[model samples]
Target: MATALSEEELDNEDYYSLLNVRREASSEELKAAYRRLCMLYHPDKHRDPELKSQAERLFNLVHQAYEVLSDPQTRAIYDIYGKRGLEMEGWEVVERRRTPAEIREEFERLQREREERRLQQRTNPKFSSRGIRPGLTTVLARNLDKNTVGYLQWRWGIQSAMNTSIVRDTKTSHFTVALQLGIPHSFALISYQHKFQDDDQTRVKGSLKAGFFGTVVEYGAERKISRHSVLGAAVSVGVPQGVSLKVKLNRASQTYFFPIHLTDQLLPSAMFYATVGPLVVYFAMHRLIIKPYLRAQKEKELEKQRESAATDVLQKKQEAESAVRLMQESVRRIIEAEESRMGLIIVNAWYGKFVNDKSRKSEKVKVIDVTVPLQCLVKDSKLILTEASKAGLPGFYDPCVGEEKNLKVLYQFRGVLHQVMVLDSEALRIPKQSHRIDTDG
Candidate 1:
C-alpha cells in the first residue's frame, strides 16, 4: 500500500517518469504497466544481494507511482506537475497563496518519499493495494423514444428522485409519473396514463396510451483540437431544455416545409416536410400570433446574447486579473530567488526508454538522460540553472500546462533525512543536519 501525501509534498518529474509510461496511456494500460514493472523489478529477480536491494527499492517507487497514476483524481494531479503537483489540492484549487519556494518544497518531499520507497522495494514487494476500485451503474426504462405529435419516455435509476402528477381538465384527467436515475452518466425512467371525460353527454370517445411521456436521451463527447480550445458534440432526442439546446443549434440549420390542409376537422390530416422536425403552426393568420411571438423571441434572443457577451467579458477580465497576479508572483519569486541561492535544483526531464539489444543474444542497459528546465534550481545557495536554461533543455517539456504545482524536498541535512513540501512559488530552507556523537564518525 502506498501512503497518502498531501499535494503540499512531491516531485513533479519523478511523478511522471515514475510510472514509466506516456501520459496518454489509458487507465487499463496504466494498470498493465504497473503490473509489468512490478514483475520485472521484483526483488526476487536480482541475483546479487546488492542488486536485489536496488530492485526492491525501485519496485516500491514503481508501486507508489502506480498507486497515484492508477487513480483518476491523483493521476490528474500527477499529470500536471509530475509527482510534485499532488501537494496542491485537486484540480479545482490553485495554491496562489503559497510562495514558489514553498511549492517546490512540497514537491521535493513527495519525491524523496517516492525515492525512499523505491529504495525499499529491493527486498520486499508490497503489492497490497494499487489504489483503484471499479465504479458501476444500473438503469431501467420503457418507451424512451419520441413521436411526431409529442413524447414518450420511461427510465429508472438509484441516483435520481421519483415524480408523479395527476391533473383534471375540462375534458379529461390523467396521471403522469417520471423518474431520473442518475446525474450525467446515470439512467432515467418515465410513465404515462390516460382517462376519458364523461361519456354520457357526448359522442363516443376513448383514450389510448402505451408508455411514458416526454423523455429524450442525450450524450456529450469532446475531443481536444488545440491548446487553448476543444471540439465537442452533443446528441439528443426529445423536448429541448438545459443542455438539450446544444442539439437544437445543430437542427436549426436544416430546411423546413409544412403540408397543406383542405378538409375541415377537429384534427388536421396535414403532413410536414421540414428538413429536421415538423412545425405545427398553420396559415398566414396563424402567422399573426407567430409574428408577435417571433418578435418577442428575437428580443429575448438579443437579450440573451447581450447577457452572454457580458458574462464572457467578465470572465475574461477575471482571467486577465489572475494572469497579472501570477506575473506579480513570478516577479516576487525572482526577487526571493536572490536569498535561497543554493537550494535544491529541481529539473523536469523526459527520456524514451529504448531497448537496443543489438547483439540479439545478450541483454543491454542504456539510459539517455534528458533534462527539462522550466524553473530555476537552488543548489548550495547559488542559482546553477536559471530559467533561461529552460529554453535549451531537451525533454524538459511540461507534460501538463494550466496546472498548479506543489513541491516537497526530503534530504539529509546533518545525518538524518527530513521532508519538506512546498507549493509553487513557495520556499523553504533545509534545516541544518544535527551532528551527534558517532563512534564511526
Candidate 2:
C-alpha cells in the first residue's frame, strides 16, 4: 500500500488496518504498533525528496492513528459508533451503540420506528361509532392457534343479537364461517377473502360473502398515499340490489368513505354516508379515565401488599447488605486483578427496584447497591447469572417486595462504558452491545 492514503480509503475510515492491529487488540498492543510505524516512517530518517514526502505522509497517518486510538474513551466511541458519533449533537443520548455495527442497525431501527409512528398515530383516535343507541354489547375472542381465531358477540337492546364467527388465515387468503340471528340473515355463511398484494405500498383484497348479507361479492384495495394517508376503492356486484362503488380516504387511524349505487346508466345514486365506527370514544375513555383509575388501584393494592410483607422485606434487605459487606474484600482483589489486564469491570450496579426508572409517582424505590457482589461474580471479564430469579442471588433482596424488580448495571468492558437494565426473572450476560447504554463515554 502507498504511504499516502487515497481519498477513497480516507472516506472508508479503516484506521485499524493502517495501524496493523486487529480490532480486538489491546491498548498496549496498539501503542506498540503505533511506535513501530512512527519509527519506520518518520520523515527526518529519509534522504531523497520523494522518500521524504512519502515518509511525511506515512508519519502523518501514523500520528492520526495514534491520536485516535491512544485515548480509551475516544477509541471506544470510535470503535462502536464510528466518527459520526464523535460529531453528532447530543451524543450523550444518541439512541444506542453496538460492537462496530451501529450505523446500519440504527438507521433501520429509526426508519421502522418512524413508519410505525406514522401508521399507528392513535394518541387521538377518531373512533367510528356505529350508533351505540344505549345498548349493551359484549365481545369475546380467542386465538386458537397461529392461524385460527374464534369470536362471539352478544348485544341486547331494542333487538336481541348473538353472532359467532370462526376465522382462519392462510398465506394469502382468509376463510370465515359466520352464524347470524334473524330469519334470512340467520343462515350460516362462509366467506373467503383473497389478498392479491399486501406490502408497504399497496394492499389489495377480494371477498365473497353469503348468508347474512345475501350472496354478495366485492373486491377492495388500499394504496399508500404517503406515510400518513391511504386511498382505497371497493366495487360490489350483488343480485337484485344491483352494483355499488365505494371510495375511501384514510388518514392515520381515521377513515372516510363515499358509497354510490351504480344505476343502469352507470351514474352514482344519492345514498352516500360518511360515518365511521365509534371507536374513538373508547380510546378517549381509556386515556382520560380508565388508565388513571387502574394505575391508582394498582398502587393501592401494591401498598397493601408491601405493608403486609414489610417485616420480611426489611430482614431480607439487611441480610443482602451484610452479604455485600462480606464480599468487598474479595471483590477488591478481583477488581485489582481485572485492572491489571483489560477486561470487564463493574463500575456501578444496583438490584431490586430499577435505578433508571424516572417515575415520580413513588417516592421510595428500594434498590441495594450490589457493585461489590457483581464484581465478585465476574469471572475472566464475563458476568453470567442463572435463568432463575435474580432475587435469589447473593446480595439481592426484593426491594419493592410485591412489585416487579429490575437490576441496573453500569460497567466498563475493555474501556467502553455500557449500561443495562434487566428484569429480575431474566438471565444476565454482560458486555453485549445490545444492552449498551445510549450515552456519550
Which candidate should be chosen as best, given lDDT against the real structure?
2
User: Best-fitting candidate, measured by TM-score?
Assistant: 2
Candidate 1 wrongly placed segments (more than 4 Å): 1-11, 14-16, 89-441
Cα RMSDs of all predictions? 26.7, 23.5
Clashes per candidate, residues 3 or more apart or on different chains: 67, 7
Q: Kindly report the root-mean-square deviation of model 2 from the true structure over all alpha carbons.
A: 23.5
Task: Mark the 10 consecutive residues where model 2 has the least summed lDDT.
Answer: 270-279
Tens-digit per-residue lDDT, 297-381, candidate 1 = 5566545554445544354334323222223333346435534553333222222222345643321111122221112222343
* Candidate 1 clash figure, as a count: 67
lDDT of 2 by residue, 264-352 (tens): 23223412211122234435755787557756765776666666667766876775565555455567878888888878899998776
Candidates' TM-scores? 0.21, 0.37
